[model samples]
Target: MKQRFLITILVIAMFSGCKKFLNVDPLDSLSGNNFWKTRQDAETYTREVYRLFREGVAIRTGMILVGDLRCAPVAYGAYPPRGDFNLLSSNSIRTLVNTPRIQGDINTYWQVHGAWDVISDWTPIYKVVQAANVLYEKAPDVAEADQSMSAELIRKYQAEAVFMRCLSYFFMIRLFGDVPYYTNAYNDVPLPRTKDVEVAKACIAELEAHRNDLPWTYEDPANRAVRAMRGSAIALEMDLNMWLAGIDEANKKMYYEETDRLGDELTASNAYKLLPMENIAQVFAGRSEEGLFEVPQNVNYGDVLGNIRRTFTGAVLHYPYIQLNQNSTKSELTYTDGYLKKLYPEEANDLRKKYWFDNNIYNEDGTMQCFKFFNLALGENNTTASLSNYFIIFRYAGALLLQAEALANLEEGSQKAEALLNQVRTRAGADLYSAGTDKNLPDAIFYERSKELMGEGHYYYDLVRSRKIYNPDYCYRPISYGNFVQGAWLWPISEKALVNNPHMTLNNYWR
Candidate 1:
C-alpha cells in the first residue's frame, strides 16, 4: 500500500498543480497548509527531488556533455567527422553552439537542441534544490501531525533532503564555478552568484551536521543505493572537499585533510565496496553493493529516462548494441589512439581493457565502443533496444580513487596515496603501483581514474578541479591560464536567469 501510494503521488505530480509549482516556482508549491500532515506526504515529496535530478541529467544527456566530453581526447567514428566532437575536443564553446546544426542522424545523435539548452540553463537543477528545500523545511512538521511518524524518521527524511540539495550544488559549482545559494523554504528573493568556495564550505557544514541522520544502508533491496545512505553523504562530502582543495589554495590542506579522514571513515565503515572486475556488469546494472548513489534507470519497469543516443553507450555502441538497420555498425565516437595508449600502454596487463573494449580498441575511426556502461542487450542482436544500465553518480571505486587523490595533495603522503590507488588497480587485475621515473604517484592516480571512469561523466571535471585543463600534457583541449582566470572553464549562464533578477550576470568570458 505504501509503495502504491508513492507511485500515485508521482503520477499526480506529473499532472497536477504540484508539477507546475515545482517547475515555475517552488515557493508556490508549499503554500498549502494541510500537505505536511502525513508521513506519506513527506516521503512522496522527497522522492520528487530524486526524480527531478534524474530528469535534469538524463533528459538531455547533461553529464556526458558537461562532464565527459570537455577537454577529453576523442574522435568521430562511423558518423561523419562532424564539427561537434571536434569543437568539444578543442574546447570551442562559442563555435560549437553557433555552428549550423548538421542534417539527419548526426543532429539527432548529438541532440544539439537539448545540449544547447541544458548547457546554458540552470533551471532544471534549481528545480531539484527547490523540492529539497521544501522537504527539509516541512519534514520536521510531519512528526507533530502523524502519530506514526517518529522524530528519527522525520530527521532521516530531512537528511535525505539536504543530501539532494548539497549534491545539486556540488554539480553546479563544478559547471558554473559559483551559483546563487539558498536553503530557506519558499525563498523567492532574487540573488547574485555566490563564490564557489563559499558555497562548498557552507554545504560541507550542512552535510556534516546531517550525515549521521541517514542509515548505513537500506533494509529494502530496491532502496539499497538509490536512497541516500551514510556512505552516500560521506562520498559527496569527499568530492566537495576535493573541489574546494583544488580552487581554494590558502585552505587546500585543510580540505585535503577532511577528504582523507572522511575516506578513511567511509572505507572503515565497510558499508560499501568494489565488485570483482568479473562482475562488472552487476556494478553498472544499478543498486549494486558498490553504488553509493545512483540515478535509477530500469528498462524492465518502463522507467527508462533520456535519449540513449546521447548517453555514453549511445555515443559509442554500434551493431549488436543498437539496431543495424537504422544505425551504423561503427561507433559514433571513440577515444583517440593517443589518449588510449596513454591510458593503457600495450605492455600493461590490465583486465579492464579486455572487458570494456572491442577488438578495434586502438582505431581512430569510430569503430571502438566501450562495454563499461552496458550489460546484455534487451533483445537479440540488431534489435533497437537499450541495454539495462543506471546513471551512477558516485560508487565505491570512485570514492576510493577520490580518497587517493586527496592524499596525493597532502605533504609526505605519497606512500599512503599509493596504497589507496593500488586498491583499484589490484581489483582491475593490473600490476600494483610503485612511483616510477616516468609517472609520479599523482599522475598514476589521475590516469587510473581516467581509465576506470572513462564514460561516467567525471574526467572533464577532474581536469578542471586538478588545474589540468590548462596543461597540454593532461588535456587534449588545453586553455591558457589567462583564459582560465577569465572564467573560460565556466559555462555561460543562460539569459533566462536574468529575466526577473536584477543581480544576475552572465559568464562574460564566453562573450
Candidate 2:
C-alpha cells in the first residue's frame, strides 16, 4: 500500500494567500495526470466541485437573488443602499436586466451591486459541472495508479461528482429555463441548449443508479449534511421530479407519484429530524441533522471571506444584526402585509411567527426584520456587524413539505399528505391539520412552506413549480399562463453565452 497524498495545499491556495495561483486558474489542472494520482487526489477534486457550487451561489447572494427575491413577499422601504426591490418583488425581469449603472446613480444599485452576475452569469455553475465532469471521468484512473484506492471508494467519489453536476444543471434550468449541457471532461465542442425536461430525466436516471453508492450519513458530525449523502441525492431527485412535473404537465401524475415514494423512503430512513422551535437558531447555524445540504459559512474563520454583507441575510436584516449607520434600525426590505397575512393569519398559532420576526410580520414599516437567518456578529464599535447563517439549500423539514405536496397531488393520497404536513407544523407548534369542508390541503401545505422556508431561497421556485404563479389567490405577483408559456419567468441568458457558441440563444421573452 502507498501513501494517500493531501490536497490541502491546493485548497488553501485556492481560498487565500496566493493571488497568482488563482489568476492562472487551477480547474484545468485536474485533467492532467500529474494531479489525479491517489485516493486523496480524487477526494480533493470532489471538494473542488463543492467549492465551485458555493462560489456560484455566493455571488451577490446568487441563489436567494434568483430563487427567493423575485416575486417574493418583500417590499422596498425608503432606505439608502437598496437593490431594485420593486423590480425583484414585481418579477420585472426585462427592466431589471436592462437597468444600467451610471456613476453616482442610486437607481443602479442592483446593477452596481452585480445583479447581472446573479441573474445571468452561468460561468461559475458551468465551472462546477466541468470540475464534476473531470472528476467523474478521471477518478477511475486513481484506482489503477494507486494500490490503496479501492473500487468502492472510487465509485463513491464518482457518485458525489455526478451529484454536483446534476445539482448545477437543476439550478441552471430553474433560472434560465434551458441550458447547454455536457459531460465529457475537457471537450470544447460547442453545444446547444437541451430541453430542460430531457436534462432532468437524464439526471434522475443517473442519480437513481448511484444513489445507493453514497452513505445515508457520515460518522463525522461535521461532515453530516455538508457532504454528499444518500439523503441529499434523494432530495435532489425529489426536486427534479417536481420541476419536471411543473414543465412536462402531461405526465405530471407520474412525476408526483415518484416524488411521493422518494419522500417516504427519505422519511423511513430516520436519518434526520426537525429540531425543536427553540433550537431554530441552531438549525440555521448549519451542520445540524436537519440540514440536508448547505453551503457552509463561518465568519470567524472568514470562510465566506469578504462576501458576508452581501449574503441573503443582509438584504432583510438591520441594526443589531448589521449596522449601516448610527441609527441603522430599519432593514432594507420588508414582507408585504397581504402576503404575510396569507401565510400566517392573524390568529395562527405558529412558533415561526414568534421566532423568525422582529416587531411584526404584518408591519408595512421597514423596521420589520426576518430573524430566520440572523446570527449576529459584533464588529469594531459594533458598526460592521453582519449575520453568519449558513446558506441553506435543502433541509429535512423542506423534504417533508415536498413529500406532502407530492402526495396531495396524487390520487387519494391526501390523508398521507396531511400526516407529513402536520409533522412539520407540529414541530413548529403550529396547529396540526384536521380536515374541514373549507380546507384545501395543497394550498395549506404550500403556505406552510412559505412560512417555514421563508428567506431560505425556496419560495419563488415553489411559486413557479406549483403554477401558483398563475393564481392571484396564491401568488402575490401572479403571471398570466400566456406570459409564463413565453418564458416570462426566466432570467435573460447572458449575451456572453453567444460569443463563441453559435447555437446559444437568449431568453427572448425578456428582450
Candidate 3:
C-alpha cells in the first residue's frame, strides 16, 4: 500500500480537475493553520517547480522539437544501427532502431505525428506556472509564521518563483503567438489568450521587480551553476525586449532601447565572462564561470533527462558490417550542404568549429556531429548517462552576443556593436570584420549570433524573430519559408489542452 504522506500526498496538486488544481485551499483541511506554518513548506513548493528544468528531456515537455531539432541546420534522416548486417536484418531490431528515429524524422521518413505537441503540450508547462503561483502567493504567510525565516530568505524564495513564471511565460509566448496568462491557481475557468507582445512586456516587468532579490549564486555551492541569478533575469529581459523589437516594427526603437539597457546592465555586472577557447567544452559542464544560468546534472538525478547532444544530435552507430567505417554511437541530427559553408567558411579559421565539431567522429561520410556537448563529467565512469552534462540554459557568450545585436540595430550604436561582435569573433580565432563589412549591422549581428549560438537552442528562434525565416536565402532545410510565412511556424494547440475550457481558442492557423 502507498504511504498516505505527512501533510498532503501531493506537494502541489496534480490537477485532477479544475477544482483540484491545488491540494489545499485557504478553507481546506491542509490550508491556513496547517500549511504555510514553516519555511520548509515554501521551500518544498519552490523545489517542485524546479523540476521543470529537470524535465527538459521528457518527450512531452522537452526543448528538442520546439527549439533546436526542428531548426534549419538539422537534416533528419537515417542513422545506421550498432551491429553487423546479420544482426540488423532481424525485424525486431530494425524496428527498434529505425521506427522511433524515423517517426521523429522531418525529412526522409516524413512521418511526424502530433509534431507540435512534442513542444506545444501546455499542460505540464502550466503545471509549473501553477506551482510557482502557489509558492509565490504563500510567501507572505510563510514569512509571518516562521520566526526563523529571514527577510532575505523569503525574498529569495519569492524571486525564484517569479523567475520560474517569467521563464515559463517567455517560452510560451516565443513558441505560441498568444497564450492565456495565469497568475493564481484558484481561477480554474478557461482564460482567453493574451497577445505575445503584452505577455513579453509583463515577463520583463516581473523580472525587473524581482531581480534584486536573487544572489549571484545560491548558498549551496552545488547550486551555484544551476540556480537562477540576477544575471539570468537581466539576460531574459534583454532577449524578450529584442524579440519584441525584431517582430514588431512599430515599437522597434522602444524595444531596442530597453534591449540595450538590459544588455548593458548584464555586461556591467562583471560577474561573467566568455570561457577560454581551449576550455569551451567546459562551458556546458555544470557551473563554469561562463554560465549565467544552467541546470545541474549529475549521475543520480540526470538519467531521466535525454541529452540532445549525445542522444539526438550524435552520429549513427557504426559496426563492421555497416561499411560506413563509423563508430557505434547514435545521433538523431546532422548538418547538410549549406550550414557549414555559409557561416563558417573554410578560410575563416574559426577555432570553435574545430574545437566543437568534427568530421570524423563516428561520421565517415564527411558529415559533422557536434562535439560541444560531449560529456566531460563522464570521462571515466561513463555509461549512457549523457545527462551528466549540465544543461547550459544561459551563458556569458549568449549574453554578450544578444547585447551586440541590440547595439547593431541602433543608429549610433553600429560601431560599438562591431567592436562587440569582433570581441567574440577574435576570441574564437576568426577574422575580425572591418567597418562596412556587412550590408547592415543587424544582418551582421544575426549572422554572428547564428555562428556563435549554434546548437544552444537559440538559432531557430533567432531566425523567426528576426523575420529571417521569410528570407529563402537563409539555411536550406527544415521548415520551408513559404510554410513559415503561412504561420505554420507557430505550433498547433494540443486537442487535450482545449478540453473543458470554453474560453480557450486554438491558434487560428492550426484551427
Clashes in each model (backbone N, CA, C under 3 Å)?
1, 0, 3
Give, for candidate 1, the lowest lDDT window spanning 10 residues.
Answer: 19-28
CA lDDT scores, all candidates in order:
0.78, 0.76, 0.63
Best by lDDT: 1
How close is every model to the real structure, measured as TM-score? Answer: 0.91, 0.91, 0.83
Give lDDT tens digits, candidate 3, residues 233-266. Answer: 8888888888888667798888878877887777
True lDDT of residue 221, candidate 2 = 87
What is candidate 1's local distance difference test score?
Answer: 0.78
lDDT of 2 at 510: 75
Which wins on TM-score, candidate 2 or candidate 3?
2
* Clash pairs (backbone) in predicted model 1: 77-366
- Candidates 1 and 2 compared by lDDT, better number: 1
How do the candidates rank by lDDT, highest first? 1, 2, 3
lDDT of 1 by residue, 336-452 (tens): 837887787889889998889877777777777788877754444523334668888899999999989888888777889999899999999998897775458888889999889
Instruction: Report the alpha-carbon TM-score of model 2 versus the true structure.
Output: 0.91
Candidate 2: tens digits of C-alpha lDDT, residues 1-511: 1222234344333333322211223454454556777777787778767877886765434556566778766766536655666777788877766778877777675465545545586766776777687788889888777888888888888889888989899888998887877777655456789899999999999999998889888999888778888999999999999999999999999999999999989989999899998888878888888988888776675644455435666666666666643457777777774777777787978888888876566776777777777653334343332355678878999999998899899878999999999999899999888877537998888888887887777888998988888788777778888999999888787776776567778899876
| Candidate with the larger TM-score of 1 and 2 | 1
